[model samples]
Target: MANGQEWWRGSVTYQIYPRSFMDADGDGIGDLKGIAQRLDHVASLGVDAIWLSPVFPSPMADMGYDVSDYTDIDPTFGTLEDFDALVDKAHALGLKVIIDQVLSHASDQHPYFTESRQSRDNPKADWFVWADPKPDGTPPNNWLAIFGGSSWEWDARRRQYYFHNFLREQPDWNFHNPEVQDYLLDCVRFWLDRGVDGFRLDTVNFYVHDQLLRDNAANPLPWAQEAVRPFEMQYTLFSKNRPENIAFLERLRALLDEYEGRTMVGEVGDSHHSIDLMGEYTSGSNRLHMAYSFELLGPDFSPKHFRSRIEAFFKGAPDGWPCWAFSNHDVPRHVGRWLEHAGDQEALAKQAAALLLSFEGSICIYQGEELGQVDTVLSFEELTDPEGINFWPEKTGRDGCRTPMIWEANAPNGGFSIANKTWLPVKPPQQARAVSAQGENSVLAFYRAMLALRRAEPDLRLGNTGFVDFPEPVLGFQRGDSLMCIYNLSPEPVTVDLPSRITPVLEQAAEVGDGSLSLGPNGFVIGRLA
Candidate 1:
């Protein structure tokens, strides 16, 4: 990394789903104090910063994504004082605080939305995306909601259809309205002034839409097996990834630029155009610092798939920076998703961590990923994720991944909370891999070692990636002059010919190599180039 480089690039960010991180009030929900108390644990992992999910006041419809107030801390989570203390403590511990900014929409209960819907002539009337119904009283266009059903909902008071790409209660803000853009920018300023180091922009591409409200074209491959959301059926050209979004991103970047070293990373959700948009959003110094997409979070774990995704971004966006992760609140844990090829759960966890750390971009590690936590087994009755409830058998929702972090192996509820009933069940398998149990000679330990190695090795942390030629099921890449990484994503042992002059610097196992390397199922090796 260059001197005076932005802190976000090549940094390891630990994400805390506030609701599931830790509960301080015994309300079965995590809060700022709980996070403050746990800062040392995150800091001990050698991560550069923490990305906290939304803690703003919400109706919990989309679980804090539907913000009712942009400034106030939710009472359920904590008070403003608690948040201030969290910032103080995290900074004391040398951890930067990056928060989730859901700028695209607000809760229906928000004052802006309430007043916008009260009458068509109110001062806030144009704050939201409101459209008139057609002659048949149907929605103005064929846009679909990501949660399910119609993207536009009928409001009795306004007698107009409001656009909501998510839940009906979470209405999309009209970014085309200059005043609306200014107001949202003020919200960004408010947090930045309060010392938030950066923002993880949620649904960055969804910030703008086609002003003409054109219907989305049908997806070219309707017969393909898609994920949990029904919104994937459409091409989403008009509904999201609008050209107008770039200027707004520039505006956001300019605001953050006022604060020295502050940065922003956007979440791009479009399937076909995500990488291209990521490139466009982060190409220049005046735009977002980095961006992430759901491409790697999908079910494909093959070497070819991983290679293509990384190579495509490098080819398409030479100037853009990318952030990579295997699991998050939205997707199933990678361990469970790739369990068939991994053979052993423990080995797979280390393999996944190694693979993510070896990538040539910044990395995000979900809360339980350090402990090698897999998805919790959820019963139908205990599930709380709306997406999971809708897609039961084929694709159980994200609740499995959103389960509370296990801090204690034997303690009740894994010491997540004092409450008798958790919103999501913490299974025994997960509890066994709790942070306490894995503090030594465990997967968490492996993660710490790998992260420390990355920080110490300049080539691994800030080097360009060049793919080395390798056979099927074997992925090989060299980072700059020294670090060479190889991953075998197969169920059977395979022999690989190594570069004649290369020697082992770090290997995941004792028997990693002896001139010609023999790799076990899902095995990996890291060596220094001679």
Candidate 2:
């Protein structure tokens, strides 16, 4: 393996949502101690690192994304010592620790925000994005919050409207303020000094909003009405993705460079411009190590869609790197999200694992994905996600996938918690696919095998890719010069001719007879060409 300096180039990172992963002290919510206890399980998956979701001090208004204090561990999770212990445990297990850092905004309850909102004349008054209302007493502009409704919240103390991209409790910071930039950088420095490996930057594009305070233009066409949140109805050109963001990234990169083996992967969340932004953010070595967009998280699983996304990114920024993920804490589980295209849940899960691991970039796997766990069905009353609650009945929200991980099928609460109630329910379906119930040839086993294969083959990990011209459902691509990866996106058998000189490398679930490769429904194959 490469030294810590370059270990992240094409590493596999498993994301653990602390609240739902495991609970120590019999608490319903998971904590740092719970994560430390589970390090062996994470290390067993053959993953290079574990990317924990936010565990910093928070009110849980947005489920930890709204951070109040960046330097300390949230009391709900554990003390700072517990976090340091987890890092030690992870490192001893040969697993790197990457944590989510939400710098775009902070909880309104944060002391900085509290002081900033006090009459607007204090030293921290410019810490948050504040603007005066329009002549008619409306919000500063037509900007809308991602959760719903207006993005601006009227503040009684400051008598100004504060900008919040998501929830009102989560206020966006004014990046134009130099002091604000220094504060955020210092917060990151605190974690880097604590032996952290990297950061998964939340809302990376939202760091620097337009200083002009201009109104976001309406969604051009086609996607205008098809949008989910009102925030999606507009292009959001001025509100985010500002040109000034790159400078801040340079500063962030400089900070990371001070550490020996630190890295950063930003989340670019623009609906239309995510791909382009990803290119710009990662093109230069002075910016993020990589950036991941929601391009693959969407429902479009066709060959063309997948091919175009990969090709477009490489074409735009040949020098940049990308981190790809099919599912994370924020979205629906891949099996449940693409259930229609999957003939069998187990088959699809294995194929998805094979496919993602075979891709030519860093990969992230959410906890429970290897167990083939689908989203648990939850009633409205059981929902805890604010987005789901706001769009009730219509959207089930993220709670379905954020349920407690099932470690033991028969154990109460799937052995995730000893408490009578978990933060989210562990249902029968999820319990059935618990780790203890998995056999030698289970989805979990397939993931381990795929990861091992990736580690053994340097070409598959850090290879240059070229798309193969296969039909609609069969997505084929070549990794470097020798390795070829093909996936049948749909639940139907497909056959394609093998390359002139080829030997099947990872064909446990694929069949090859005569001169053609036959893939079963939701099957994938990897071959090495002579």
Candidate 3:
């Protein structure tokens, strides 16, 4: 990377979901103290930073995402003093802390929203998105919420409809109001003053909405195999991904720039225009340091899919930077998501770790990814996520992936908590792959090796990539003329001719014999060109 560029360029960040990471207070829920106590394990992975999910005060309406207080920590999680200690411990371990900033919306229980709904003439009345109903008392627009039903919630006190893109309890903030922007900026400053190194902007494309309150158009065609919610039918142009969001991001970037060596990564959730939006949000220096899409987090795991997604982003905006992750808190774990393509879970996990580390951008490794954690099967009674409950049986919600982290094989609650029950149950299968069970050649060790390899080789981190012409299951890419990274994403062993100038790196998952390179099922190799 360029000398003056921020540390986020080609950095690997470990994502910690607080509710599932560890429980220090024995309340069966993870908290700030738990996270602070676990910094050693994160530092051991050779990652440059840690990106924490939301830990702000909330009503638990949407876990911590539907934040009621932005400037302080929730009592359940701990206090502001505990957060400061985590930051200090992390920095001492040479790891940066990048917390989630849910700027697009706030909980309906928030003081701003409470005052806004009291009366139309209140001081904070315009702080949120509120619209008048039609002549027949219908919603002004046909936009739908991500959770389910209409996006607008009828406020009895104001006798008007308020916009909420997710849960009705989470009201979308009005970026059109300068005071709202100032108020949010002040909240951001609160963290910056507390010594946070960076932020991961949650639903960054959703800060602004169409001022005209226009209806969303129907999707040209259903992209997913099944549509579980009404929101999927529409393209969602008026509800989110507005052009005015660019100016707001610029303002946010300006605030981040005030701190030395700080960075920002925005999450773009738009399926159709995510890559283009990622390019736009990160291309200019005045915007996000990096932005990630759901492209890698989806069910598509073919060589063509990976190549096309990577190539398309560079094609759209060559200067734009991207952050890639195979699994996160939102989606089903990649192991289960792409299980059909796996010869074996362990083999696939190792191959995936190598492939992700070889990619030419920043990387985010979810908490359980190193342990090869799969989605745990949960019954309807065990389901806690509303997204899953809304479409249960047919579509399992994210509860499977959000189970507590397994740190020990035999310990109760898998060492996540001392309490009798966890927020999510820790199944026996998850405990089997706990960190304590890993050895020198285990999946956890393989993750450490892959991360070390990425750090040892600069080209794998920040090199220009060009795909080699190859068929399905075999992905070949040249990184900066020196690194030739190849992967066989199939169960059957395959052989490919080695270019005369390239010498194999002889990594554990790869092999070279005579003039041919043979890759085992779910194997990969990174060779250095002579």
Residue 418 error, candidate 1, Å: 1.4
Single out the weakest 10-residue window by summed lDDT for candidate 3.
500-509
Q: Point out where model 3 deviates above 4 Å.
A: 1-5, 222-225, 506-509
- What is the C-alpha lDDT profile of model 2 across 1-530, one tens digit per residue? 44668899999999999999989978799989998887899899899999999999999999999999999999989999999999999999999999999999999989999999997789899899999999998998888999999999999888899999999999999999999999999999999999999999999999888888888888886877776677779999998999999999999999999999889999998878888999999997899998976889978778898888888888988888889999998888888888889878888898889888888778889999999988899999999999999987777689988999889989999999999988888889899999999999899998889899998889889888988888779988899877888889988888888654467887645787667788888877788876
Residue pairs in candidate 3 whose N, alpha carbon or C atoms collide under 3 angstroms? none
Q: Please say which candidate is ahead in lDDT: 1 or 3.
A: 3
Clash totals for all models, in order? 1, 0, 0
TM-score of each: 0.97, 0.98, 0.98
Candidate 2: clashing pairs of residues: none
- Cα error, residue 360 of model 3, in Å, equals 0.9
Candidate order by decreasing TM-score: 2, 3, 1
Question: Residues 53-165, candidate 3, lDDT per residue (tens digit)?
Answer: 99999998899899999999999899999999999999999899999999999999899899999999999999999999999999999999998899999999999999999
Q: Please name the candidate that would achieve the greatest TM-score relative to the true structure.
A: 2
The lDDT for every candidate, in the order shown, is 0.87, 0.89, 0.90
Q: Higher TM-score: candidate 2 or 3? A: 2
Better of 1 and 2 by lDDT: 2
